[model samples]
Target chain A: MQLARKLAAKLVTGLVMIWVVATATFFLVLEMPGNPALAQEAADMQHGMSPAQAASATAVMFGFVPKQPLPDQYRHYLWQLLHFNLGVSIAEEGVPVSHIVASAAPWTVILASFGIIFSFLIGVTLGILTAIRRTTRLADGLTLLGAFINGVPVFVIAIMLVFVFATILAIFPQGGTVSVLETPGWNAGYLGSLVVHAVLPVACYTLAGLGAWQLTSKSSVITVLGDDFILAAELRGLRPLTLARYVARNAMLPLFTILAISFGLMFSGAVFIEEVFNYPGLGELLIASITTKDFPVLDGAFLLIIVAVILANILADLAYPLIDPRIRRS
Target chain B: MTRLARQPGPDPAGSAAAVEAAPDSVLAPDRGALGDGDAAVRVRDLTVSFPTADGPLPAVAGVSLDLARSHITGLVGESGSGKSTLALTLLNAVPPPGHVDGGSVTIEGVGDVLALHGADLRKMRGAEIGYVFQASQNSLNPLKPVGKQLLDLGRSHGERDQRVLLRRARALFDEMGMDAARVLASYQHELSGGMRQRVGIAFALLLNAHVVILDEPTTALDMLTQALVLEIIRKVHATRHLTTLVISHDVGVIGDLADRMAVMYAGRIVEEGPTVQVLAGPRHPYTRGLLTAMPRIAGDVSEARPLPGRPPDLASIPRQGCVFRPRCPLATRACAEAEPPVTVTGEHRFACFVAAQEVS
Candidate 1:
């Protein structure tokens, strides 16, 4: 019953977001002064040749056909979206935007999956520990450490790790997933290298995320401490350690919503991490698309991320009923 | 059989003596170690204080009680009576900002409960000593089925097979007037107010707990449910021979269940004695006032009277003085200054300095 309401609410919120973002994308693209024409103008200024033919060619490059009205362009844009036809990338020399994203998407997905799983495991455990030892020197020390790591930006941490491992230690490769000779294959050695190369980036993201996880856990413990259910558990003569685990576990119901946000945010710093590791991911495609103004690829990447977030939120909403009774028949 | 002496009153000692005669139940002389009152639990010179914004607020102010086995003792008081505080001292489960500064919770055949900790205390809980909270909602785990909760309570002290657990749970439900199967399967939120209280009691009694400290078990229930739960408690007590400590602010409610009743004002035990003795002929002014205030449902419509004033603000009470003196109707210059120790006779105890004079 609750799942249905949550899904409905989530769907409405998602649709509203999609509408606003789609509208913003339309206006922002329109707001850009001269797209391919400016590129053509700049090219012409650089070279002595008149490049007048390139001006019309450049207009075609931006998917704006000759003399099309603004409404006509928007209609075409919607049609392309309906058909899932992300038009050819300008910078990638006519390569379809879908292929470019798909090719790089796997690596980014793998890295993010590992990072998310690792963060939940270690971060949540530390959070539980922090909560159990609450107000003690140990809890205080852990909070300080978690806060320090979480306070720092992911990019800064990634770079620092890169310097320490690649530059100073020289035990690991500086960038990319595989050796030049190995190329990309399913071989054990090559797979190991890919995982090894991905380690620093994953650690960087997970470590940066620990602060919030710990804080959430501590607050959850504090919240659960007042619970009549927890007191009930104590009166049942549950071992103290067992009782604490119950507190930490039950308190994670609300935290699960935030965990879903973390799921959505898994790829948030993908652009930065992918750059550091040289892993061929959607982040690279996104970066290139932004710099070269590859509108199809840019729109597709942004839209995909927004959709994933919507999906994550919906999943969280459904799971809430199963976790908390107040929200169940609630 | 011999009846205890009664102090003379204007109504005549002979007429009062006729009313004071014991029922047929007392015809048989009680036996065992408990017959002579070797205090199953002795709490002496216990003074617990909680720190407030201003200074330390005394909760169990030099309180004492001798709970003999095979008997029911009532700890009564209005809201802030410190009756609950006196009850908690027995378990040593006092939370932050409060501590047992000058007292010991000792049990006969068992060691001092206050001295025991870690495994010793944990073992004592739900085994020999059971605790029931005022709110049944606070006692039962919301997420779990009642059967599982009952089984867990037993798991602490002794092992109970699933069969035994299920059997006890069914018996408990049957005793409480609930459907055994449905109640055992149901969650805390699923049960009605009365059903939840039944479940709480079943959990406490599953281990056949020797010392059951019930802290106002019927506070959250409606009048009908309160009477029903109280009836179940009375039945369970006679059947199990459980040493029960029932806490309540209402004098009549305690009057219904407790064999002996103790009246607490602020943090001090103003009066405590045999239930009928205290109720019919209360010695302390506070106890008398509390009994006088009880509204007679069927007779003497205008007899009910409210106490003259509110209780004193607990935080501002002086370091060493009678806690109730500020509002005590019989308070004299002597009562205002020095706190009177609890004067005891047999099982009856009252703290008022004017108790003897009032009775005479």
Candidate 2:
């Protein structure tokens, strides 16, 4: 009964978070300095319409209508959101914002999820080794490397990786998700090309994030090693493997919370990497919409990011009790 | 013959002649009383020290002690008196920065502990000498259930059958006076202090260790819990015929449970003897001071005196003379010039130029 109440409370909080993000995005997108009608007209003219014709078309679409109050616009947006409608993109003229978001999000999910998991595994293994062999020269060198990697910005690392792997080596594609001519499918050639294209951006994301996991895992394992329970385990003459299992299990608890929160942050934070790689992820769409003053697409993309983050957080909260039984009591 | 129990302090004038005759040979005779084969655990001239910015600080300084077979020997001292360090050295498990400088800790039929390394050392630890730490609460993994932790200890020592491990754990829990099923399911936080202590003892016994070292076992426990733990120790000692070393600061607890008692001060054993003999006629001033400070149920409470002056720092412990002299009430010029020779009377062994003479 208590668990049910706690879960219900979490569900309510998540909905409120989504609602707040939706409301904020709606107002913030609409309030941007550029005139949406003018931007739409300019975009139409670039697509081969005459300037006068594009201006008249933009006016027919929205220039004649009076702007609604913030509250009224919010209510309208919320209503559309409830009915699974994200409206049409003002900059793109006829494209539905929901359709744009749906197409872009899966690419971001695949890239970020794999990148984060790979980085986490590598970081944790190195962290454990460094912590166990703390006094050695190898541990010291690894620590220095982790600190150096962590100090550099993600975009800088991404650029460096691209320059080395794609620009110089010419081994992998320089940018984009897959070759333009290749069809998306489960077949080996298509999948291989997809993976080949993902290699640099994924490497960029993993390298940028690896240091944090290594530092957290190292510190947490160090703390667990100092615990009397560990000493007790040692006194019992436990096999090295058994001892490592006990240390790893206890040390990983704090990392679990960090992992969950970071997983959520990675989706939104993938913006820079996506932009750099020209990958068609939601982050790229969000950035493109911002530049074009595409209010509907901007709002839709922000809502999706917010929802994904909130869901990840809720999953983390639910997982905590399962991983750490002590949390279940409180 | 006069009993030293009622005497407030050693008589200075009478001790002069005996002090002159006292030599190292007098102390060496008592090693034969153990008959060479009787000592379950023998520690000779054990020295453990830690490295600091200043220099090496001796924590256990040239201390020799013997635990006779199937006896409960209580090591009583204040914190920093090196009792815990000495206890840990029995398993060759002294925490780093503090290493065995020089010592030979030998268990009969098991060879020298300090000489053993790796697997041989591990085999000796839980299998031969079980150690229960001072803080019972921290001694257990909070994440694991009691039964699983116990079984893990068993499994680590080559106990293969899960049924056998669980059955043995339950039986040990029952022996330690706990509800086996309930405790097996509960984690460390769920159990009370006394229950945790009993479980720790059970963990030690799971390996059927011959010499169990309980380091300050009842230090933080309440009166009732303390009594229960002491009773459990007593029962384990009696039933298992295990040679036990119970380390604590409480003289009363030691008095209640120990067959033999050794009093430590400044990393050295100042006095050691049969518990009754030591309590009745403590030959060393430090031992007498401890006995005098102990609160009795019917004593003049106002007369209970706390030992004056703090214990000396290990780094600058007097290299030439007795370590306890700075705090010794009976210290004379002779006590400061040279290290006091160990003096033995019957089975009682103590290091004091003045007190031993006065006792004789």
Residue lDDT tens for model 2, B1-360: 111121222222112323454444454422312434457777777899999877888899888888887899999998889988898888888998789998678775576778888988887678777888764548887788888887777777888888988888889888888899999999888888888888888888887787799988997889988988889899988988889999989898898999999998888888888999999998889888888887777888878898898876776578778888888898999888987767777677888989766766
C-alpha displacement of A285 in model 2, angstroms?
1.8
Q: TM-score (chain B) for model 2? A: 0.90
Question: Per-residue alpha-carbon lDDT of model 1 for B1-360, expressed as tens digits?
Answer: 000121111222222324453332211111111222335566666788888887777887777675756578888888876887787778777665688888667664445777778877776677666778766555665555677766666665567587887787798778778899998788777778777777777877776666777878888799999999899988887777777888888777888888888888878777777899888878788888888888898868588988888865577554566667766787877776777655544455676777755533
Q: Name model 1 segments beyond 4 Å from true.
A: A1-20, A37-67, A169-174, A271-280, B1-39, B51-57, B158-160, B292-314
Worst 10 residues of 2 chain B by lDDT: B1-10
DockQ, candidate 2, vs. native dimer: 0.61
- Interface root-mean-square deviation, candidate 1: 2.5
Native interface contact recovery, all models: 0.32, 0.51
Query: What are the runs in model 2 whose C-alpha is more than 4 Å off?
Result: A38-66, B1-33
Clashing pairs in 2: none
Evaluated against the true structure, the overall lDDT of model 1 is 0.72
Question: Chain A vs. true chain A, TM-score per candidate?
Answer: 0.87, 0.91
Each candidate's number of clashing pairs is 0, 0
lDDT (10s digit) by residue, model 1, range A1-330: 755776788798888897678657765755655565466556855776455655566556655452467788778877887688866666765677788777877777887888877777787788878877786899899989988888887778889988998899987777786776665778888888777787887787677777778787778878788776676555546667657656765788778898887787555457887877777777877787677777667777777777778788778777776776655564
